[model samples]
Target: MPNPSSTSSPYPLPEEIRNLLADVETFVADTLRGENLSKKAKEKRESLIKKIKDVKSIYLQDFQDKGDTEDGEEYDDPFAGPPDTVSLASERYDKDDEAHSEGNQFPPIAAQDLPFVLKAGYLEKRRKDHSFLGFEWQKRWCALSKTVFYYYGSDKDKQQKGEFSIDGYNVRMNNTLRKDGKKDCCFEISAPDKRIYQFTAASPKDAEEWVQQLNFVLQDMGSDVIPEDDDERGELYDDVDHPLPTSSPPASSQPIDDEIYEELPEEEEDNVPAQVEEQRKMNQD
Candidate 1:
């Protein structure tokens, strides 16, 4: 049986694809915000994300179908650096912090505290620093603990390469599946300062469970941190109230029922009187 927690996106979204989707979203939002574009005109034009759903769908399916058998069950990246030591000296992300590359300054919780790990798996992540010429997706081991989430190069070394305080963070799933995702398993994380990061899961079901755990942590902590939207979700996908359109199911080919439109026949006056006389005689009897 397939692992219940495994998601459809064994591979992460490519850099080019992520950038394209982000650009389309930016264009549509900018157009809507500008005084130049009328409501009628916006409605008339094709939706930005809807136009590319098919492309993303095809790419995602094709990628998954490729015959490659590397069991992800064994994800052990050799942990580099010294003994685990996390410092929460700064509330905001410190770009200069040599210990944390992602700039999140949350102090690392004891590994033992993560007794109830919501998820543990291998996923390819877009590098914090990327190159255009090369499709730069870095591989890392990801896990969600009770209070925090951690990603690093290895399970043995236990060096927390990157970490996120799940509580109070705004998480959003993609509107459509891409070559690396299914049922919108892709998602992006936004920090309070508006920095965004994207990740893809192995399948749609896995994504839902993951998001639920993230929200649960926030509630458990009673955190008041309000996530800032990045000039409108610039990390390829997230929550937009008038949300990006998702890929809907195909319409059925069956014809409409004719009985619904058919009219009832009128009652004849002669038959109606006879029926009334019979009813009166029966009542008298």
Candidate 2:
């Protein structure tokens, strides 16, 4: 083991840690050469190797720079060396912090930036009720976050009524009957859990936009678990029952005849029965 007393840097990585890092590098390299690796897997391994090399380079540079310092004297460092040297070293040599200190090429991510709103609006959610109607559409304020769909009683409501993950859910435009028996512009989020959430948008366009955004999010999440084709969807996601089609078919499309019926002409007094006429004459007399 190299003498710690000979090292000028106050926080130098231990020999065991250096050996472990080396072993990690070797393992990562071997794994990278393996066949049948996905593109994402290969990219991640390459990134790991780059990070290891960069960390090793930093320690070598630090040692060389502080070599001329007084023998057996520790250099001043901002961090107090903790017993867990690996944690301390990681903190002291954090590349992200280093980049920020030297002037970041990219600006720091803001809280809003981390989870930008995917979609937000007022939607009527079908909730169960004990009223004459088994279910009713209650308007809800909704927004899509990185991991889940959040819904509140109103836009300003801090307390969310409910939320569900988008992992294995599928979104599609589905029309359903309103209380007045008219179909509403709606969509549904169905999952393998057999729990279907239905929402009514203000308009067909709004419903379509919601579906598109949610579908895009599911696809981006890399959850190919939900199949795209409607025919194949039943095997993966719960099939929601849509009461109506997007639009009602025109009456002209029906098989009924186009012929118009003419009205029959009324008979004159000559058509009256003789017994009925005689009875009416005697009553009048």
Candidate 3:
């Protein structure tokens, strides 16, 4: 590694730049030393003043050393060093193109061309009971696609800690049952097994749009159905559970890209209560 003392001065130091820097430095210094500062101020003024002075030191040294450049162009910028860009020889690029053209008859198709593939990507979702420390409604990045849903602690995380199927589910806008301020932009998803998942978007429109888009995907897959547990959901879900389609997609893959959101196989992890089990048994009559 090169020594920091050997660094070249950054440039384009014209008369205008010098005057502007001087004005800024003077203004900052005056503001720092002013006696008429607000009495209600709670910030550490000393720390801010030191930070400004440190930045000014870097700029001042750079300007003084660069004051003598003949050309108007910037020279020896600290932010930009030697240009690493290089162009391949024309003959090499031409030969590579020729080889590439001799390979395939048809160009590869992209996955987004499939039918009913409305929208799919990672989105911020907040669980109802995720009150970490003292903050309410902690957000998690969730991956949503036509058939699968995944959530992780962060974007670059190695493995997802929790996930659920998007198929055979119902979605609806959040209702203010828990009395948690304005929940107009919150929504809930209820799986076939009666497990409810809640998410809040940045706005009511965003939440509604997500619910509508999810409902559309479910309809296409044949899992669109109205939910039948309004009272049960009111007791458990803080938001609301809207009716959804009751269809399931086919087993075959579609034209859409497989790399988008990897589909999760249907999981059967329902732990229905004894009352619900008895009700189902009675419904069979």
Candidate 4:
């Protein structure tokens, strides 16, 4: 370490260097005064200011070269160093290639490809109000049904001429009907091309099987009847239970009555003035 008293100048820095030092000091002071500075940033700024001051002090002192040598050559600076340009370029190139490859890849399949459908067996049970599987079973059925619909129903030939039908007997309680008589449940089938087919089934499973067989026959005949939208197909099953709306009823023009006015007597000009004058007098008093 060099002795501080050995220096001729009382100040560590010369006049010009002192001015530069003063500017740096003022800048550091103002930055430290900033309220928004984070603790880490304040510490970093303080460290940097100290380093700058140390470098300035060394430059101002003009101390004789210590001539610290490494194999007869002066020591080279470590901090003021050049980066490895070649390595940086290689990394950048790799990132660009990865981005290009990702951009060219195919898009993922849409979630709408999966549709809901009731299992044929489940539908049979539901029709008769029989004990059936729970919600998890229904969900599993939907997944399997979607797979089957996509695999068999989506075929162009099957979709064009295939048909779906359901049949199950439902008992109706009517005040006018005889207690012993049961209503017949008719089977109705609609082909993709708007053709209708009818059949009778003793049970729900039988009805579903009949429809499946019909679908197979249509596929064998090169008829197409697959649904275009999976979501739309799911909606079809839901809407089957609900009655469709007919045309809306026409609007009616009706006059509304004024209840407050109805209680008042027929207006007379003198009576109105007297009432108003009496109310005004009461308020003033």
Assess the local accuracy of residue 142 in candidate 1 as a C-alpha lDDT between 0 and 100.
75
Q: Residue 230 of model 4: what lDDT?
A: 69
Highest-scoring model, TM-score: 1
RMSD of each: 25.3, 23.4, 29.5, 34.7
Q: What lDDT is reached at residue 51 by model 1?
A: 44
Give lDDT tens digits, candidate 4, residues 1-285.
243334244444353544344344434543244346788988987786666545544443332221211112211111232211111222223224334332222222222333454333211011111111111000001112322321111122122111122222112212221111111322344434432323334444555564555454444345356534668888888899786978664444222235445545555554898999999999999
In candidate 1 the C-alpha lDDT for residue 186 amounts to: 73
Per residue, candidate 2 scores C-alpha lDDT tens digits across 136-251 of 44456788876577665456553454666777888887765443322457889887744577888888888899998898888878855643676677645543654445776688
The TM-score obtained by model 2 is 0.36
Off by over 4 Å in 3: 1-136, 177-182, 223-285
State the lDDT of candidate 3 residue by residue for 24-105, as single tens digits. 4333333233345664442555554444344434454554344433222222111223210001111122224334433222
Q: Quote the positional error of residue 132 for candidate 3 in Å.
A: 9.3
What candidate 4 gets wrong by more than 4 Å, as runs, is 1-14, 56-285
Candidate 2 minimal-lDDT segment of 10 residues: 70-79
lDDT of 3 at 23: 38
Of candidate 3, the 10-residue stretch with the lowest lDDT total is 82-91
Regions of candidate 2 where Cα sits further than 4 Å from its true position: 1-114, 177-184, 223-285
Instruction: Determine the backbone clash count of candidate 2.
Output: 0
Model 3 lDDT, residue 100, Cα: 41
